[model samples]
Target chain A: MLKIHGIARSRAFRCIWAAEEAGLPYEVVPLGFAPGFKLERPLAINPNNKIPALEDGDLVLFESLAINLHIAAKAGAPLMPTGDDASRVMQWTLWTGTEVEAHVMRWGYNAYIKPEAERIASEAAAGKEALDLRLAVLERELAQRPYLVGNGFTVADLNLACVLYGPWLNGYDLAPFPKVKAWLDTCLTRPAALRARKLREG
Target chain B: MLKIHGIARSRAFRCIWAAEEAGLPYEVVPLGFAPGFKLERPLAINPNNKIPALEDGDLVLFESLAINLHIAAKAGAPLMPTGDDASRVMQWTLWTGTEVEAHVMRWGYNAYIKPEAERIASEAAAGKEALDLRLAVLERELAQRPYLVGNGFTVADLNLACVLYGPWLNGYDLAPFPKVKAWLDTCLTRPAALRARKLREG
Candidate 1:
């Protein structure tokens, strides 16, 4: 009953993980930003022409994290905890976008997108250092709790996990942060989260 | 009373503008993401040490746009319009973050932060192109409707207007996009918007 339009490898991963975690049945229309008839269709749904545009009944929203949070909130489930802890939960999601995700993009671009001759060794090094520092913050925060939001799992953890795991796919290591490594183990063990990853990876 | 921490030049401008537009009275605390006392405060509201945090009673939140949307929704006197037309309004806000704000950061960094001689002329040119493309999109979208939604001004317009106008401070121009310029003129010139900008820039 919901329509999600985006390619799996793009920002759409956030929404895919979110939908699977929420147990919501939805259709995935694999589309991206490049010019094409299909891309035009998603653009109609999202004027900005961004990925992971969602249509739920009459409601439509874009912005990868916003879509995830919306699904988690509307599902009225534990993927997003409620009450006094709610703001902090939201804080984590925003943290990834503001801090971790920014560095991930820089590092990911350097590792893959930038031409070898054009790559800036210093920028990549700086990005890696910043990423590790961020993970250290996360490591300390996650050490006291099973998930990013405390004893229960939420979209916040899932969002961060996706970013942490992405760099590893390209050969970055997570061994330096024991707590983050363990947190990743706990997050991957979730049936729903794994299911979502399986579908995306497939 | 609500408390918002951050300066007018910061992203906190969005949160403060939303509070004012919603007619919600708030107090502003001078804060910027820099080394100082605010970062040392234990049980600090923001874990990443970023700014533009809001405290209403015990409900604390950060991320300027998120706080804006949250405030708008709760104010029933929302800055967003109603009905199916509302999605278009929503789209504008997302575009602000994805397009206008993004390119602003790009050129802003190059023109202001990036050291001269090291700054790539291509990046600055790309910023010009991005500004043109974004303004053109805004022009086409705004031409069809009086506001981003319909005839009513919403927070969507406010957010985009704030972002679109930033390049002006850096001496960047938007002279070609008459429609966008007119739309900003109407939206930003309003009493509420003027007041909010005054408070933010005051």
Candidate 2:
């Protein structure tokens, strides 16, 4: 059995969504946090001690996006693209990690996660401004295509949608980028994504 | 021939290095920054207006690491690992982007890029402290094996070596992590990397 070592509420949610999409049965090890939100202990599987490490027999792996890519590769086709489309998948995935995610997290933490008193309004506003610039790029791309790669849903959509999910659920308005909002809705409404959301909500 | 649409000084250096390693012929389209180091105009090839976009036939891709992955995929074999090792390559690449690169850049900018008057000693120290934690993880992994993936040099090593190149070149000492220093030396000294360095230097 494949084991994912992290809580559902963490970035591990991405791997869970990917596993669900790929129809890969996996167990969550429910690793929790120490005080101050640190990992409870150093993870042997991930020397960086971050959450969402995947264990597949002897092959232990870290990085949530990379784990999803591996799951897609293992499941093959539909989830993973072939030929140059594979590169497109990677392009969007890497783009989201570098360009979109940090801003999303900053906004999410201030808007949703942090205690109200600890939240910095300026930081959240700055994050949103940064996101507005990047979302315009995504909005343009989504206006041209139904999905991130090719015409079908793939791990790229899954990876990016999961990154946006936090802010979306916390009522971050997507009205500004209708195409992005529509595309994200199409991605999150999939049966697999719904199932993954159930695990997260629980 | 691949047309890499960025100068050698930007993150595009990674792609240039990867092309050299893969023995692929490529041309650089010099992209210059504006007065504040911002892109002078919105780039058509990359809506993000980022440097290091790769143009291959009809496919246009941004994100330097992703471009290198694509180049590796095109070249195949020794540069791009097969099977699960491909996942390992993705793993290290993503890990470096998320966990390592920003800190390296922070340290690099304060230590090397910014005029001395603009450099913040505390920020540089903080970046170094954060990098020390991450490098310890890398040091452990390198100590276990000479290369990042499998027994051979692959894109993972190439991706990470380039990220550290700025700090390493600016005299950030790697003496504390002897294994990481040795492995980086091995990677940077390759003929391909030297060729890429010449492009950067010239």
Candidate 3:
């Protein structure tokens, strides 16, 4: 059996959603985000001490996107597709992490996670501006396609939805990018994503 | 022939390096980084208006790491091992983008890319500190092995080395992490990377 370390409330939700989409049985190690969490057992599997590390027999892997991709590929889920579609899936997944997630995290930390006095207004504003630009790109793209890759939902959607969850939670308005907002709503309502959301909320 | 957009001096270098490593013949579109560059031809392929978008037949892909992985896997290069080794390669590539690259980009922007008058010293310092912590993690891991995954060079090393190039150009000291410094030296010296570097310089 595969074991995933980290709570679903973190980036680990992406992995759990992928697992659910692939119908893979996985056990969660239940790591949290409290202070001093880095010095705990998560370090044993991930040197970065970040959440969503995966252990499969002799192999250990960290990085939530990598873990989700591996699970989707292993299960031959529609979430991954194949060939050129697979490349698009990879493109969106990587893009979500590089171009979007970082900004979302910045906004999240400043707008919600950090103490009121510790939060930097300028940084949070810059994060919001950057995220708006990126979301506009998504808006244009989503206007032409129903999903990120091909016709149906894939791991790319799962990853993007989870990353956007942070911005959504921060109460950032999604109205400007109607397509993106609609697409996100559709993605979040998937049976698998709903189940993952329940687990995360719990 | 495959086409890669953007100048070799940018993130496209990673894709070029991967192609060279895989012995794949490719063409360069020679995009530039200027104020209106984003609204130009790059947007036709990448909605994000980012460089390093790839075109192969009817398929288009963006994200340097994703492009590199597709080329490596397609060409069956030593740059991407098989099975479990491939998973490790994926883990490190994604880790490079999420952990190391972001901090390096932060430092690069504040220290070099931004005008001196606009640069924020505190943010640059924070970036440097974050990079130090991440590099320490790499140093510990590299002390046990010559490469990021498997016994030989892989696309993972190529991706990591390219990301570290920004820090190297910004004159961040690597002496404190001898193992990481040594590993980076080896990866950058590969014939493929050498060719890519030359192209980037031109």
Best by lDDT: 2
The C-alpha stretches of model 3 lying farther than 4 A from their native spots are: A34-42, A115-121, B34-42, B110-122
Candidate 2, backbone clash total: 0
Query: Per-residue CA lDDT of candidate 1, range B1-202, in tens?
Result: 8788887667777777788788888888877744453444533766557777888787777677657766666564447554544444444554565456767777777776578877877887888887777777677776787777656778777777777656754667767877777787887777877776786556
RMSD of each: 4.3, 2.3, 2.7
**lDDT of candidate 2 over A1-202, digit per residue (tens):** 7799887778898998999999988999877563345566667768887898999888899999999999999998889989888999898888878888889988888887999999999989999999989899999998898999989999999989999998778898789999999988899989999988888886
Tens-place lDDT per residue, model 3, A61-105, is 999988888888788747778888888887888888789888997
By descending lDDT, how would the candidates be arranged?
2, 3, 1
- The better-scoring model by DockQ among 2 and 3 is 2
> Candidate 2: which pairs clash?
none
| For candidate 3, the TM-score of chain A alone relative to the native chain A | 0.93
Report per-candidate DockQ.
0.28, 0.85, 0.76
- Give the per-residue lDDT of model 2 (tens digit) for B86-186: 99999999988888888998888898889999999999999999998988999999988889999999999998999998877789878889999988889
What is the i-RMS of every prediction?
3.8, 0.6, 1.0
TM-scores for all predictions: 0.80, 0.96, 0.92
Model 1, A1-202: lDDT tens digits are: 6678887767787788788888889888878744452566427877666687888887788777767777777675578776545556556665666667768878878876578888887887778899988888788877677786757888788777776667756666688888888888777657876776776677
